[model samples]
Target: MGGDLSQTEVLVIGAGLSGAIACQRLARAGIGVTCLEQGEWNPRESYPGDKPDFELQALGPWNANPNIRRGKADYPILDDTSDIKPLLFNGVGGSTVMFSAHWMRFLPSDFFTYTLDGVGTDWPIDYHELEPYYLQTEADIGVSGLAGDPAYPDRPEYPMPPLPIQPWGEKVAEAHDRLGWHWWPGSNAINSRLHQGRRPCVQRSTCRAGCNEGAKGQADQSIWPSAIAAGAKLVTGARVARILTNPQGRAEGALFVDEFGVTRKACADIVVLAAHAIGTARLLLKSVDAAWPDGLANSSGVVGKNLMMHPMNRMVGFFDEPMSSWQGHWGQSIYSMEFAETRAEHDFARGAKWNLSPTGGPLNAALYPLDDPQPFGVDLHDRVDKWLGRSALWGMVAEDLPDSHNFLTLDSAHSDVDGDGLPRLHYETSENSKRMLSFMAKRARESFGAAGAYEVAEQTLAAEIGWHPLGTCRMGNDPRNSVVDKWNRCHDIPNLLIVDGSSFVTSSCVNPAATISAIAARAVDRLIHCRSEY
Candidate 1:
């Protein structure tokens, strides 16, 4: 409460994936926009993968888990109550800084889950409504992929051609064909040919630790530069402590700590929260006031409930010959949707999306912290050599149904210097998710066996792989049951907007970045069109 109280037409919290898109769209519309990001922009040269000793650094400082990295920008997360640990980065690009850049969209059946499968709640919006935005965001983010896959509906081609499938990819594809299962070249955010100013991928296979080749579609590399070039202003190293609301229960702005550790207030006509699911829900729950005793826009008591962290199961195939697996795009060579949609015979209702990815360098095979250690017992050197250039993984991203018990809340046990409670994740893998994982594991081994794998390893529900956290502050029509409406506006406060994965109603099995961008774009477009309504 010391610095000058600032005001902007639009205030955006978080400079991550969806937040960057909201800033871009609002700035493009000539609106005055200011974004406050908890983390500073990381220098491209600072990324570890460029150095000769990259594997050493990737294991230490560049790890995706905030609890492990503990960088200056990262905050502590209480995850002892959770089965699967949540993973995210706290920088301008958010978790995109460390993501494998797997760009995927929800299938048509995904939106109609409650209608068709009678499981989780249905979205107020549908796939068809978001399809145009998906195409637009794909072009904006410079995605690379082949168009006509039988797994999806008719869509336009990607901005660039698909990356090379390599010998390993070809083997997997041929096996899928022989087994009569649906598989297609993976949609990657990396560049095949130079489309934007960014360069093509060098295929270093150290993608999870940031790309030195400037190919992966992290928001910092692909979105923010242009957003800033437009009229948007981005302030780094600003951690929002609380969202402000007026007597009318309308969002005013946010109270945050600046880089210099000074408390400040930023007021805006409209405030947008795009800090992903966990961060967004935490902020809302922490924003309790007199008008809204529980939290801002907590009429439904859904601000921090129904958390869905898209849980994944990892299984790998060890081949006889060298696949040169360390040198290709680790962003998924190909993906199988044979179990993406539910079958009538399935005891479980929804399904999982499986991505085929290359196993990384020798250091990755050792498994210090990245994932569950492969079960090969002794002869460490021999196992590392055997697994390094010979294994490919079929990781299943399973759909997580929303349950109130598996949620996020401020941990009462832990408090920061300001005495504010830290965010804690309380999640349990459901029986349906377990059923999906078990079923997919069997099918995955069969598919790999078809590709002539001599041996296969299974790691059921690894702890360090909650890459897609979603559905905490879900969107729906009824105010009593949901946090936000179809337009991405909170039911309790229309002036307050949430344009992130936190607004998801259902956790689709595929990667959520593409859908997050689409939803952000659509939400901000509506905001621009109806700014006076607020």
Candidate 2:
């Protein structure tokens, strides 16, 4: 690679959800922008299909645990103290390449969690501030869902109608209705019809392996392409090592190792970090300099503190009748947010949200809990017959609060192939999180029983991993306690910004892709509008 300076008005790191959006917004504003990404582009055609061995590929690199994935682009993480494994993709699209694409907005109460629930820190921004950005992101990504969900804020109709509700979805909806719970058609980032010139999903039910069709709302598919076309440069295979600052303590650019293992410097007028929670935190912690011996933006001494992950639990129900589990989208089932907020009667500060699916594909269903022995002969025949098209799985996501013990730091004992210090994540489920999971698991079993399942079984939570990592570089009003300010700019480094999930102060009890994108959009818009102030 040439040692050409990253000649741009703004340089963004990571080409994932937030990074892609930031680039698009900046480039569209006619400001020169460039994106530096560690991983290479994964062509949509390369996504795995529904073969017998197809599910194995997900376990290899798509499972979210870099250690288990062990791909060349993935970096190893030291998570011995964590209850959940970190699941993320390293390439252009980030984790959305394998995400379930359940696009949910954070409830109003989520913004005031600290004030209302007395648990997590309250976000500097709220749902109302992000509502318009949510709408814009939904249209840009072609989200499909119905409006008028009483459980959420009032918003315009979706870009398209909800995906066709299969019989399984209807069954789950009926069960929730019977239980007097609010079940709505899930808000999905997957296209229901041909919108934005992309073809509708073929109902592959293999989203985790990467969406072969352009139906899913991956950053690589939707945002990155537009940004590049609008004059944003995307430099892949550039793994950023540390952020560089000048004598005045403002961000100058970054030092990265190119794909050829050559060290280079890419300077810019402004630098944005959108490498997700762990990646962003790791880079900042590793950049120990003369002015700042701790990190680039560690003046508050909170660079890697307050890490959080949404604890998840799974419940499986085996029915006596066939349900044709293989046909529709795996994550397009009913979504219930009845327990998304905390109640005074409950000991936990926050509750959980759930989505129901048929655990699509024979191979995936065969390896449901991942520890069960493969049956042979008559046992195989019986197990297959019982679960092939007659079962449903409930994936419950419970909110986790930031704890002092749950944090990320650099591991001096381990380093990546590029000689960058590995991330040592010390995270464990909090007592409140455990209680929330237990309560949600009981509710899941009850729902299955009410849905007329003959047998309902709860999977042991040991195999579960934390999802939707957040809050390592949290934003707040207090500069002494937060890494970034309300505008997503580093308090210590005025020219530095963070536009990923790391800036989130609280993790709502839902998939956070939509929220992350909304924040990126809002941050870039604010930056451009207030550039003269800076």
Candidate 3:
């Protein structure tokens, strides 16, 4: 059977936020770029606000839909291993499709955690190096927040205004103020005002179900469109099986399977692995050949070693007043950075933020209360309905240290639906991580108490799951302890760049996407400058 093989100046695997930004930057530099996504190109109109569809996308089956799940299907986790669940997205925009749009850059101290606090690994590049790029990315994605916030870096003003504070936000802020905690409007990727061609957020609450209003700036609605408009080619439903390397051990292209399961080859002068942390590391580990038997860029055996995920726990509170928590952007509202800074003398874990998350609809709310095995009846329904609007839910996203034990390995028994062995996550929170989470949970409890919550209930740590997984393929100055260099180019394979959460050396206390995008932009600039040498 005949098949198609194509070539471009640069080939980006995964069409998620990082891949989309990389493609956009590369294409704007006059480079020929092609982005291959495992999921279809789902437009904004396809996302509907329905409980069943939302639950399906958040749970299974439809969860792999790029329009819904993003690139979650590429890396399935065995959440049943422990009580804690692991969430991943499968699709073009990846997890950004369903992410909370919490666009936060790590504090300057986050980069020097090990050096300053004597814990974890220090980032090869510091916040100063990434500050400019962070500003650029924030502007590019239309982040909304005020500058001069003590919790964040002193940066330029956000492109758009902050999302309107909700009743829950006001309450949280009041609690923080009373407790002497630092609180601010979270830097969100959702548009608060009109920017570019996108419309302002209409205060529609179901952002996880996919924003039909085109306000939340997922890659599909933001960078991917700009990249495609700038002459970049996006091929969806294409799964990259492995990276193709020359005899010199330099990456040349990739072997991919199309939607029809037809094997094809695409040669490129440069290959970028933006397939998230686990997927990128797995691809490198799977690309063994004559020159490198272990993996493509596994000379240091650190491709998947320093796997880190932000373990999160939620604190639910019921109030007598009507807050209507589910009335606006899912990620919109307030953030508390009171505990984000590390204190070596305090013997405390890293600080966590308490952000106001959307109050779930009927089905999602059911999952929470039903954890107690309560009988389903009118009492349950009445309780759920009464608490639904008045409840204020806050999530504690604490940092997890990178450990060899918390890693991703190929599951020998599990395979994709097509029988290809999918990468299995062999992750467990370290003792230190659990301790940190416990510390953060205690703080969350205090915050809830201060908020005058009538009944504050903290979920058990066993129910905590990591949504932001980072540092699977970290970048460093030396290849001995890292997968890629400071410029994000693989040490063994100079032409191969891994730009994503995978390149993070340390899991910061904040969300990773803003940092990832800034790093990708910086890498693209470096790649462009070194194009002639290549």
Candidate 4:
């Protein structure tokens, strides 16, 4: 256990999105960095998108839900008491491997949620402070879209033109135009054209399962390889058990299980955690010691509190036109921000974002879920034929207010199914989220009707759509109420940093991949410049 693997200037845990960014930055700065990832690199060709049985595979083995996936890398989160199931892919890319690659920035209003909307607490840093990092991350990860949307403040152009908004999307766009609503071509991490040595998307549309063509900007393709080339050392299948701290209460490194089942201790001057909201919180709570009897850096007793999952609703519009609706990138074609910000007219304090995306293949069409379940046996062919190329979905992501009652806890199991202990997630859909979903779903039906959809069906409060896990470990100016500070440094442990969704102060309605990258880059910039202090 006390060998060559145990020494580093900096030790980064979870070699996913933020971990990749941290390594890349530190390596570029010539800092000695070593990263440990629970999952190994999944080769581009290994993705199931190009395979013949893509649809069947997507439902089971390649599913985004870790409980269903149960891959070698994935650890389960007990969700029997959860309103929405936790969905994450554990690999070099993290959840980006399964994400549809909607690259969105948080609106300026999002930073001052508590002040502007009288609800969730405000973020320590504002959008203007994070804007530069956002631009940097977009360029680094290869985002594609036409800019100059009026929904937010004016911005610069995108790297490439917008991805094709298919016929189904065009209809919705036209409807939004007619209704005088705000609809813009979606900005996505998936390539519209080629950029940074990756192929352009051919639009096979199995994005959630994984993009085999390397068109989507998964961290494995877009971030990690470059980090490795820049001299960062990444060790795969290194499952961290707990963080190691010194007598002075500084982060020394970590204790982990190597691929060969050997318990190893890594020594470092600084430690960073980029493990997602659930895993990062779980890891902290599990890393208990005399100094931190509750959890590492949990002096405020809020390490795993204030969970926000961005509860969602889906509305399907069935058009008479056969537009090959299933063929395009499942990534958003267009998104509406007409109701993104709060208004006094609405009883809810915050808002929801509506994204127009393609529904999947035959199996997804046949088993298409609405408020009422469809029976499997009756008129299967008719159902499939009607839904296959005629359906498009408007998914509403509603921002949830952070609640202390919604939290993550550890079961007292010596070993879980993976022999790595499992975490239990307790969540209840908030009244604010339910109200917002109801209001947005009704508006979605109106938009569909305006788009000339023959029939519109709704799936309100979908349990299967918990994609954005955030706000478990919030950042704030006061150490008494938060886990991290404005710079993402732990208030209790000076040398420990958390640069992932776990540090989010408020849940934004849009997808958080872009914001997460920006946060990591911004935090590391501080770390590199202030290295002498640590």
Candidate 5:
């Protein structure tokens, strides 16, 4: 399985959400495709939610941080210089295994941020161009929610009904209504009713720990199976070393180390790198040779620049009455996007969406105090129990403006077992982001107060890792300013395509999985239409 390889029409580097969707679309177009995954296959029942030792896994490798959740497939990322550490999974489904399953789409204005708000680079493609693909991706994943929200553009109805609102969501809704702010049940990837042979969500509320019910839209549970059934092949435990190129400066395929530690080459007519933002940038930066000394497809010298992540802040509200905040379901019940865009009165260029996660699990409850002051022995138990059933956590996702200073570069000092350079993230909050966080924090406290919170705790401007990392390898109309073109094809290396979060131009103030899938869908369509170019 290591040494020699068969060349296929398409080779996808990761079996994550983008890769799976790309494989399915390519296969449907009568093209042969194969996926190489660094992690092993994870079955639905393989998730450790029901085990007695599951609670401890959160403190261990199952935590969001790769340094903390060091599994066999995980690679090290250096972040000593960065404020926010990145959290990711290397398996077939990628980070969706630990994601909150929030499936919000980017608004039309998000794509035109540079033109509309005078900040960030504008996306070469617009929302109307990707709206069809977004709808297709939503239907394929079986998203649950009500459409026709006044804040968003006109869109198709969701595949399934919205999840039942919890006590926390109801309180948030009431507060928003009183304040004349807009609120709606968030679009979730978790199923409320059985769809496409999968079971409905049972309200276990442990989605980030991995879903045991196969109801959450992890790529492994959704499109990966469809791609496999369509004759696309997948090879697990294969860590890609670099993109292999020819004298013509076109991508031929990738060189990787198999699970047995054997060097292997997977040749393909075209290659798609969907290893998330950080992994994709690291590989591109490391694939340097005499023909292209700087790096493969890095003629613009921006393969890993302009890294962005949403700066998140959480506000907690406590009540005297016991609240049923521990119900096992999709964590965020309601969301407000009234301030998702920019305004003349605001000092920030972009804004954030506030989400109410009513039932934060025990592990999260225990960890919340780490941001605040930790309580002592007997007081710890009392505090944990008090907040466990009586508090609501509001997550504010502020839009992060991309800066060249905030970027990813390979570390000269740190290398993996295969001797490839490790990714070093250099991130800091911009002045615009700082202003946004300050404004949102005050609004959150006000909102919670309006909801009758006896006491409110604000996690202000803290150093927390962002789940959505984007803009490292951005797309644009010109090769000098971007890594990829509007079609997601590498400007320097036309045969190489990046169909993941690495291709995002802006970090829209919502979870990016939906947009990632939409990009993959649109990119594959372009690939099929221009098949002879590769």
Candidate 6:
């Protein structure tokens, strides 16, 4: 539980995608980097093979008792008035372990939100500025797909070819084309051609749970191994409580509780916080001191403000033919944006894109069609059986604008077993976001109808809780409106860098992982060049 802190050059707090990539880059640069993860490192063999076991690992065990336990200590969940539930990963690989492998880059327009559309703040850097880094990240991650697809930017074709399209995927693509929607093989981190000594995807339907076949690109399988080989150290079961700053107001180290429930300190010349959006913000707020009365980097008072979650909605359709939607990777096929650009011309509140998703297992599928159940028994079983393979589901991921009201704060009442306060999230869909959701629902219905679905049922608007959370510690040129600067260095604390979803100014319609990796890589490049002076 103890280590020599003086020898560490860079300390990364969280071993997620961003943290893993950053640590790798730092190690490649010959920097002595140490990564601290709150959960134990579960190897590929540790993943479950059965569906019930997979469900328990993926969603059930956490849901049954919403507390993170590292050995004997339990981290409690704080209840907030917000309708949305904050979900985050606490392990070494972080959410990348359970991610659907959708590695999509944000559109060019996603960066210049202010100049192009005037709805959100413009990024200090744009797509063109990040183009090279995006290409590097894609190559590093071994992305699988063809380039020259109109939906994505022109770049080198994916390092690996696209996975073999499933029958359900082909059907969904046909349906999308018939409805004049753009459809393409999704850019995935899963291997299609078995590059880098990893095997190709075996078409396992259980990607949401950890992948045992090494097809899905979790950091543990991809970046962590390389980082460790390059002399970087990864310390798991180390929960970072707060960043410790020197009197000179520079980040020197962190205060953390190790696996044995013992308080420890780790020092580094530079500290990078990559604990996703909520975790990063919560940690910053918890590091309050006399120099930083409000929070470590809250001079602008926007550390945990302007939180955004891309509220996701789904439309499930039942067909006469068997679609077999659950046979492939979680997000292997995507119906592109024939409608994503609608906001460019129309008066739409916001835009959305429909992507093909797994239809779920029997128990999960039954809940989707249950608006009101008829007489139970054989009739219900018959109805479920008939629609099992014949169903195709499409998810609409719409961008939710950043609002100051949607935020994360520490709850005084709920403290973890380690005596650390829990983060209580307060967020709801804005009126504008609700309108956009309705517009997207209509468009999804039209697409399903064109696909000749026997029954198209749009999901009811439940509480807006999604895995894609962003913009809590947004980066911008204006210090008053944002938490970090263009370089992602905290405005108030020059030595501390926040590189993750928390730095996103706006949540794009697509997955934010690619962008997050690109930004972290860019930040590392900056850190390397100015290390001697800083």
> Using lDDT as the measure, which candidate wins?
4
Q: Give the range of the ten consecutive residues with the poorest summed lDDT in model 4.
A: 412-421
Backbone clashes for every candidate come to 0, 1, 11, 0, 7, 0
TM-score of each: 0.97, 0.97, 0.94, 0.98, 0.98, 0.94
User: Over the stretch 317-435, how does candidate 6's per-residue lDDT look in tens digits?
Assistant: 77788766656777556656766653655555446666776676565565453434542587768657755767767777776778899887877677755455677778877776677
Full candidate order by lDDT, most accurate first: 4, 1, 5, 2, 3, 6
The 0-to-1 C-alpha lDDT of every candidate, in the order given, reads: 0.88, 0.84, 0.77, 0.89, 0.86, 0.76
Q: Model 5 misses residue 270 by how many Å?
A: 0.4
User: In candidate 2, which residue ranges exceed 4 Å CA deviation?
Assistant: 50-52, 370-381, 418-420, 462-464
Weakest 10 consecutive residues, lDDT, candidate 2? 458-467
lDDT of 6 at 375: 28
- Overlapping backbone residue pairs in candidate 1 total 0
State the displacement of the C-alpha of residue 376, model 4, in Å, after optimal TM-score superposition: 2.1
Q: Write the per-residue lDDT of candidate 5 for residues 1-534, one digit (tens) a residue.
A: 546679999999999899999998998788999999999877767777766666677658578788778899998888887877788888988888888889998988999898998898889899889999999999888799998999888887899988987777788789999999989997899999999999999887778778899899988888888888888999999999989999888899999899898989999999999999998998898899997777778888888899987888888888777776766464568889988889999988989988888645565666674356876677678667767878887888888877899999988788877676788999987888888888888888888888888878778655655687898899998999899999999999999999999999999998899999999999999999989976
> Least accurate stretch of 10 residues (summed lDDT) in model 3?
64-73
lDDT of 1 by residue, 436-511 (tens): 8989989998998999888888788877788988988899999999998999999988899999999998888999
Name the candidate, 1 or 2, with the larger TM-score value: 1
- Of the candidates numbered 1 and 4, which has the greater lDDT value? 4
> Could you tell me how far off, in angstroms, the CA of residue 484 lies in candidate 1 after the best superposition?
0.6
* lDDT over C-alpha atoms for residue 416 of model 5: 78
Clashing pairs in 5: 61-69, 203-328, 203-329, 204-328, 205-328, 205-329, 325-359
Residue 78, candidate 5: how far off, in angstroms?
Answer: 0.3
Q: Model 3, which residues run further than 4 Å from truth? A: 50-75, 79-84, 369-371, 416-420, 462-464
Candidate 6 residue runs with Cα over 4 Å from true position: 1-6, 50-53, 62-74, 342-347, 369-379, 417-420, 462-465
